[model samples]
Structures are given as C-alpha cells and as structure tokens.
Target: MSRKILRATYAPQPQGQLTMSEHRAAVKAVCVFPAGVYWGQSYGPRIVSGSNDGSLLIWDPETGVTNRIGQHEDLVNSVCIMPGARDRAPRIVSANRYHSVRVWCERTEGDWEWELVGQHKHFVLSVCVLPAADGEAPRIVSGTWDNKVLVWIKQLDGVWKSELVGIHEEDVRSVCVLPAAGSEAPRIVSASNDKTVRAWREQTEGVWESELVGIHEEDVHSVCVLLAAGSEAPRIISASNDKTVRAWRERGDDGWESELVGQHENLVRSVCVLPGAGGEAPRIVSGHDDHTVRVWRERGEDGWESELAGQHEHWINGVCVLPGAGGGVPRIVSGSEDKTVRVWREEAEGGWETGLARKHEDVVLSVCVLPAVGDGAPWIVSGHGDHSVRVWRERSESGWESMLVGQHEDVVSSVCVLPAADGEVPRIVSGTWDNKVLVWIKQLDRVWKSELVGIHEEDVRSVCVLPAAGSEAPRIVSASDEGMVLVWRAQSEGVWKSEVAGEHASRVSSVCVLPAVGDGAPRIISASNDETVRAWRERGDDGWESELVGQHESWVRSVCVLPGAGGEAPRIVSGSLDKTVRVWCEEQRKGWEEQICLQLDSSVSSLASYEHYILIAQGNQTVRVWLPDEDPEGQHMLWIKVPASPCDAIWNIDPQAGKLRKPEIIVGTSRGLATFTIEELPF
Candidate 1:
C-alpha cells in the first residue's frame, strides 16, 4: 500500500502537561541541508548566519556542518543575538534590506524559527540586541534608512513591541547598545549618513533624549561599544565613509572628545570591539572597502596600531568578533560583497588562520487531525500560545514523532482541517491573535506549506473551511473579535480573495462549517460574544446572509455542527459563558429552534461534535461528553478532569489506529494537549 508523506516547515512542541519552566528544556538544535551565509553572530559553540540567499544557517565549528533553518524575503542585512531572560535560550534578531526585522526564538521541541516583529518605513540598515540584565526583559535597537531608530522591548505577555526612540537628520546606518552600568537605563548610540554620531539616553521611562557624540567629514557607517573595565569608562567607536575610525569618550565637562583610532585607505564600513583576553589590551576590528579587515590594538601611550588581519575578494560590509569558549583565541567573521563570510582565527603559534567561516501555549490554542494514510496512523496538528503550529503522528516502531509546522506573530487562536475526500490531500487553516488567517496545504511534492490567506480588523477568534459547493472551490471562513466574519476563496495557488460574510453585535467567537443536507448550498455556523448562534448561507443575488438560531444569557463562546444521521436534519451546537450547551435543529414549518439545553456548573470554553457526542470543554478543567439524543432527556455520558483549564477541544480519528479503533477527543488546555477515548462509554 502507498502512504502519504507530510512535510512541513515551522515551530512545534509536544503533547503533555509541562510546566512553564520545564518547557524551556525542550528546545534542541535540529539539522538540515546546508546553505550559504551572510550576516552572522556567535552563540555558544555554534555560529548563526542570515544569508543573502534569504536563508538562515547554523554552522557547527567542530564538524564544519552547516544547516539552513529559516528564510526571509530579502537579503539579511544585520543579525544579532538578544540576551534572553535568565536561564532561557537567547533570541536572535535579524534585518533585511526590506522594512522587515524578525525575532527568532529557539522553540521548545522544535527548530529555531522567526516571527516578524518590527517594520520601518524604509530599509532596516542595522539591528542591535540590547544588554539585558538578569531577569530584565529582552530589548532591541534598530536603525533604519527612514532616518529613525526604534527600540523593541519584550512585554510581560511575551510580545515584542516597538517604540520610536529617536530620529536622525539623515539615514541611520548603524546602532549599538552600551553595556549596562549598575542600574542605569539603556543607552543607545547610532551612526548616520548625516556624518554625525549621536547617543540616546532613556531619561524617562519610554522617553529618550539624544546628544551629539562626534562628527566626521563623511557619513558615519558603523558603531560599536566597548564595555567599561576597572577605571576605564565605556567608549563609543564609529567608522566613517571618509576612511576614518574614531573612538569617542565623554569628557568631565559633559562634552565628548574623539581620538583618532585609525585612518584607512578606503571607507571603513564596519567596526566591532574584541575584548582583551588574559590581561591583553582590547582590540578593534574594522572592515573596509579596501578589501581588507584590519585589527587595531590600543598601545597604551603609543596610540593605536593597525595591521591587516585578512583580505576578502571584495569590499566588506559587516564584521563581528566571535569570542572563543574556554579562553580560545577570538575569531573575526566578516561578510563581504564576495558572497562569503570568512573567519580569521589566531593559530597556536601566533599567526592568523584564515578560512571560510562555515556557517553557521501554554495553550494548545487549537487541535486538528489528518486521517491516517494506508497503514499509517492519523496525524494531530495543534496551535499554541507560544506562537507555533505543530504536527504529530504515531509510528509503529518509534511511537510518535512531531514536526513544527507553522508560526504566527501572535497567539494562535483557532485551527480547522479543510474538507477533503478520502485519498485527497488534507489542508489546515489557522487563525491567530495577530488578526491573520493562514492556510496550510500539502503540495504535489508532499511538502506542506502555509500561506497567509486573509486578515481581520481585530484578533481572529475562530476559523473554519467551507467545502466546495458544486463548481465553487472550498472557502475559508473566519470570525474576529471585531464582530466581522470573512469568507476567503482561493484566487490561485497561494493567493486568496476575501469578502465580508456577516457581522455580530459583539465579537464573533467561534465559526464552523455545516455539512450540506443534500444538493443544497453550503452553510456556516457562528457563535459570538453577542450571546447568539447564527447560521449563514449564500443567497445568490443577496450574497451571504445570517439568521439567528440559538441564544444564551451570556457570550456564546464556541460552536460546532453535528452531521445529520438517519433522516434527521443537521444540528447546530453552541456552548456559552452562561454555563450551558444548547442544541438547535431545523423544524418542518418553523425555522431553526433550540431542541436541547444542558446546564453545567461552570462556563463553557469550547465545543466539538462528532457522531452523536458533543465534547464540551470548560475553563474549570473539565471536558464533559454529552449525548443530546441518547435518551428521552439529554444526559451526560462522561466527565474527564484535566490538569489545566481547557481552551479548545476537537474530536479526531484514533491516532493509534487499533484493531477495534474508535474516534477520540483531544483537549487543548492552558498548558498542553490531552487526548481521551470514549469507545467504551455505556449506552
């Protein structure tokens, strides 16, 4: 028998009840095919580089193996490692010639992936990760050709937000953060095309003030900071297009004085400080248009002396000092127009060895399932609060394995599997708090890829896929916190068009596609904070229209549809904050009306229906299975308490695919995923 292979790219985590701190230990470096390198930074024993080819590579210095792990739309211009919270993996910041600046975090149980964080009105020229103190939140500084500098801080909720910190008279070329001094606020320095270097001090919380540090005869191209040691104060270093590099120090009179560091034969394009090792004097490494990297050592009273460390085949654009571990000699990595990143390291005998620097949810917000192919087991896909989407499947020999499949800029709020007939490739749709909906489809090559399909005015609360009607292609329906619902139809592969389908009096909380009764037009079901459950169908000339079918005293938080069995009409199932689950059915003469109402002790968080069973997830840590038509009076079938508050739930095909297999219900709690079997429930 032939089996389908599902290939996906993105972030992921496993199913279990892992504490917040325990989750941090789950991250591991993954291997991939190698790619070229461009902008680079050294993290621990590994080197991470962003490429002009729009890929991010991680290089193992010992094995000389490079792996491509991430990608961008444009050439990566700058890359820096952000100091993470104490005991956490440091995050990476990268910029491209485009307005995009992305923050890549090593995801727990997954690869190092990026989420786009900030954008400028013009190209982002430089990015600097701020020096974060223990327990301090991570922050970043970016310089843009828009003549502005932005400061991004990771907020308490784990979102990175940007604020305008300063504006230059001309294009800001480079930015650097000064080492933290005692309890002082962060200090940022920037070099600009206006031929001036400026320093910004956070005089007040979130407010900045700038002062002129120094000026050059030509545009300043790069800047770096030397941390203060003993009696020596921290100093600012700037390189200019005028073939000069200057070191500036704050004078006792609050003025700044610049010392001539070095004069180059060509423009000094990049500069970085290499700290002294074993009581050695600190040195500065500068890359120049003269096609050489020069190392300048401060010779006490004799001034600074420079020597050519390495030469590139073309003009150099950026350089970074890779501090060796265990007192190993520091290495200089430079990116040049030569399309190479060369690493210059000091040999044991003292001469330099130049070589090609090898590269390099807390919530399961949503849960879905891909039916087993041939002899294979079904696959479970989930979205989490950590901004990742993961696909999990079981193997006969290895048990289960998972791959990170998608990532969003914010919390993923909902996920749905598109309607697919047996033997057809299944597709997944996800909605996120970032106000966007993305579609993941398995390609002809069997690789699963995602494309942004639509955007909402506010947080996307829920998403569902409408099956094709006659000749129409399947559509994506999404509900948002702003009370609007949108239906998206594919215009072409990887392209989509959307139209407003309906609106609610308040936030539309959940949406689900209803199975067609016969050859009738497809229908959609939606629940909202407006305290109502609504059904919508296309009316030809009237477009799409909605009719109120069910109501509760409080916000309707979740909705699902039960396909008709026997000769019965389909039923709309809704769960509400009023602690009730209501079932609606269409009558012969009357419109849709409530047929069953089951009261519970706590508010309902989510709802999922399959066959004759309705899974009701509650924030009180309980998942109650209700069989509405089981007996004369609807009765509870099973009650399973979870480890944490339930956020969402879904009924999926048994992943185990046993001899006597049965469908299962997967619950997404605040922490992770939990699955339950109900095959043996007494009738």
Candidate 2:
C-alpha cells in the first residue's frame, strides 16, 4: 500500500542560530527555551519554566527528565511559586503576555490542572510571591506597563482579592518581594522604565507607600534582592539598558549606597545569585544583550573578576540559578530570545557544562487526518514551517507513530489526504511556501511516490482535494499567496497537469470545491486576503467564470461550502481577521446574501464544516461551533477555549477510541496537535 511522507520546516528560526538545523544539530545545546524559569521549593528539585509556545515545563536537571506541567494562553512572561499546605499538591502561578495570570497544580491523574485566576489590562511583565505569615494567606504581586501594580490576595474564604498599587508611571520591568522583617510587612520592589527602583511598603491597614531607592539612566530591566549575609545589610541588584549591574545598599534610614558591581558588553537584561561552593561567598550571574551570561567573583580589597558563564546567539531574556539538591553547587538556567534555554552546572576547575533541552524544531503550519482502515486507527498528517510533512499514525490508544512523508526546499504549509477507492492505498497532496504543489500516490504494490505538479509564482498557502467524479481524474485545488488558484489533475500515475481556476484581487487564503450536483461541473469558492469571497464556475474546458459572492469587513482568511437544508441552493461560510464569521446564502438569481454573522473574540484562522454545524478556529486559542438557526444574533454558537497556544489549523477527526464512534475535532497549535471532541455538536 502507498503512504505519503513529508518533513521540512517545523518551527521558527532560532534567535542566536541561523537555522533550525544548526540549533538542533549542536550537540551541546539543549533546546528548551521557555521565557521564564523558577525553582519550586516543594517540588523534587525540578526547574519550572514558562515557554513562549504556551507551555509550563518542569525540568529534572539531575535525570534529564522534562515534564510539561501545564500550558498558558499566549507567550508566558513570568512564573512564581504559590505556597500551598504541606499535604496539598504544589501550586504555581504563571503570567502570560495575553494579559492573564493562571494557577496550576498537579492532578490525581499525573497531569496538571489550571484555572485563569486573574487578568491584567496589558502585558504582564513580572510576578513575585509574598511568603505567607502565621495567620495571613499568601499574596502575589505583578507589574506591567499597561496598568497598576496588582496585588492578588488569597482570602480565607478562597476568593482572590485584587488590589491596585498605583505608583510606577512607566513600564514596570521587574518585581521582587523582600520578606517582611520584624513588624514591617513584605516590601515590593519594582524596577521600571521611569528610571528608578521603587519599593512599596504597606504602613497602615490596606494602604501602601512608595519610596525611590535608586535611579538608573535608562530603562531598568531587572531587579533582585540579595539575601542578607549577616554583616552586609539587605542589598538590591538592578540590571538596566546602561550595560551595568549595580548594587544598592540600605544606608541609615532610607539613604542608599550605590556601587557598580559588574559591567557587560551590552545592556543587562536579567540577574541571579548562586550559592558559592561549600558556603563561601555568593556568585552573581547576569544575562546580557551581547548574548552572554557573565559570572562575577569579588576578591576582597582587589578588583572583581568576571567570566563568561553561558553563551548564546541572541539576547538573553531570563536567567535564574536553580537551587541545587541538598544545597549543593547551584546550576544556572538561562532563557534567550534565540528560542533556546541552556543549563549550566559548575563542573571541575570553574568550568560549566551546558547541556538537557529540546523544543519543537519549527512550527506546524497545517494538519490533515487520514481515516483508519478496517484494522487500524486514524493517522494525522502535518505540514510544518520547514519544507517537510509528517504522518503521525495512532499506534495505540494515545501513542503515535510518526513517518516523514515528503519534503520541499522551503516551508511546507498544507497537506490533504485524498479518499481512496476500494482496496487502493491512500493518495495525499501538499502545498509549500516555495510555490510548489506535490501529490503523493500510494500504489497497490505498497510503494509511496511523490511528484511535483503545479508551480506558482508565490508561496502556496492552502490545498484541497476535489471529490472524484465519474470520468474526472483525481484532482486537487491549491491556493497561492500571489492571488492565483491552480487546479491540478493527474495526467497519469506519475504525471499531473494544472490550470488556473480564477484569481482574487489579493492573495487567496483558502479554497474549497462545492458539492457536485449530479454530473454538473464543480463550483469553486475561495476566501481572499482582500476581504472578499469569490466563486468560480467552469463553463466547458477552458472557460471559467468568476463572481464576487461575499465580502467581509477585513481580510478573509477561511471559507467552507455549506450545503443548504433540504437541498436548498448551497450556501458558503466565511471567516475573517475582522473577528466575524459570515454565512452567504444563495438568493434565487441574485447574488449571495449575507445571512448569519457571529462576532468572535479573535481573528478566525481556520474553519471546517461538519454535518450541519460550522467550526471556527480563532487566532487566540479558541474553537467555536456555530449552528444554523433563524435567530440572526447567532446565539446558538457553542465555543470551547482551546488550551494554550494559538490554533493555526483544525480538522474533524474520526476517532476509534470506543465502539460508539463520533466525529472529534483536532486543533493544531505551535505546541502540538490536540484532539478535543465536542459531545454536544448541535446538528
């Protein structure tokens, strides 16, 4: 039997590395680069990291075991440990760029459970925890440029109370909590773009006061409070755009002593302190814009010496010293803009070993499901950011077996599995960013062959298979970024021919062939970036007529042909970047009428029609199912919040999980493809 294999681009290019190939091939490099990293006090010495790909990961440095704790809505900005009771599972709070803070804890099923506990008005930059006292519940402090410094207090009744600490006028870059000393409450220190490090203290009941401790010339990007080592009082270390790490000591009553501790080649972005070997002095580590993390060591009356602790190809965003097991030598963890997180553990002779991280090599651009045969389960075929397509066959109940089906010189963007006839193996088609369309044919003798067919002038964005007609050879439709839609028909088992169906004023994003009526010529519908949906009809062989069928307020991104109820003139549903899903129904001899319009929370990235319902993949991690009704308000739409990453591609999959087989929806995100079945798809 025949199968299609594809492997090309999988994710974005690494920041410090030129290509995904270079980054993954580097043996010493561990690939996991979550935007934020922290060590949980109760967990088993595992390092918790928040990734831009919307995952919270736990890394076991000693054993090289990486566990995905949970996921975030968007790019995760900060992660802080939440103090739980001794018997309760460890809880962690993570802040994402999507303006939300979420809390996660371990579930009984060995996975994780999380809830959206709070939201900010703008991008949340930093988060820190206030250690709980004897009678008071714990509290969390977070800061951002958009709104006030929010203090979320966990009350005894289990409801979270948010208090706004309005002080910083500009962007709050970092926040650190100084534990309450004696009778004073815990102090919140924040570094900001307003050029100063300010401390907020609650003097009276529920009232807070701000005090400026030190000022920097440029934006202060990071702040950390060094644990007082007896003789030396509490000191605040700040990193900034000025390329320096300075320490501010508390002088007599609110007075401050400024000392430049170390210098970096570029602006310093993050700072952390590691315990010295055998309880000696501490080592201060700072990450810089020069793509280096420097370690500083002081020699009493002599000058301080700095060594390059870690190196990357891009600017570093976060750095933390994962407290070692049983107070051993600490390991340094650094996250970089290069899409990599490197772990450095102090080895023999003051050297560090940088090595245990792997992220998705590249983004998956499109996915399609191949149905299971009599004895097998369904297989998921995917096109990636690179020039490759992969087939993931369900091996067991939840396990998958992956096969690289095909490859292109550039990014592969789309994949479609064609229905097979009788005992014939399946055939698949793929589109790429390199303006090439390829069809893979599975022979009866069990060999898979791929041949490049239609060639466009620009990147191919979408592809679909035309349902087979009696005499029509197997045909495939492909849309390109250059506004042209090409129809390809197999000339033979080894060759294919293409013809332009029609054109859009702007780049075409999606194309679908309407259901065939008896033996009539197939009607084609396409959604364009120009905010219009156009329909094409093939008159004879070379004659193709086109007309504007529908238009949206913004760029149209997705479209699907919806069969009318009771054999009515078929209708079309279109979704666009304007955050609206519109249905266009045929109006007798007149043009298509805009029937139903439903506003969504974000841009509709993809859409699929199942039975009588339409599924929409929203740009912001949401999938909504719209059911047809006489109500114009579209109140019957059922929606589900897709977990974590942006849903870029979606499809309806037939699952063989049990005897009662039903259609389930699978969504593709930057993290991976997830299958979530809707029990109540109102058809």
Q: Which ranges of candidate 1 are over 4 A from the true structure?
A: 1-44, 108-110, 132-134, 355-683
Q: What is the lDDT of residue 219 in candidate 2?
A: 92
Worst 10 residues of 2 by lDDT: 22-31
Give model 1 RMSD, 1 decimal: 12.8
lDDT of 1 by residue, 101-182 (tens): 9987654212355677877788888888766556677678899988999998877776778888999999999998876666
* Error at 311, model 2, angstroms: 1.3
- The whole-model C-alpha lDDT of candidate 1 against the native structure comes to 0.74
612-651 in candidate 2: lDDT tens per residue? 6777887555667667654356566666665433335554
lDDT of 1 at 386: 69
Candidate 2 stretches greater than 4 Å from native: 1-43, 62-71, 357-416, 419-683
User: Estimated TM-score per prediction?
Assistant: 0.48, 0.58
Error of 1 at 601 (Å): 38
Q: After the best TM-score superposition of candidate 1, give how far the Cα of residue 4 lies from its true spot, in angstroms.
A: 23
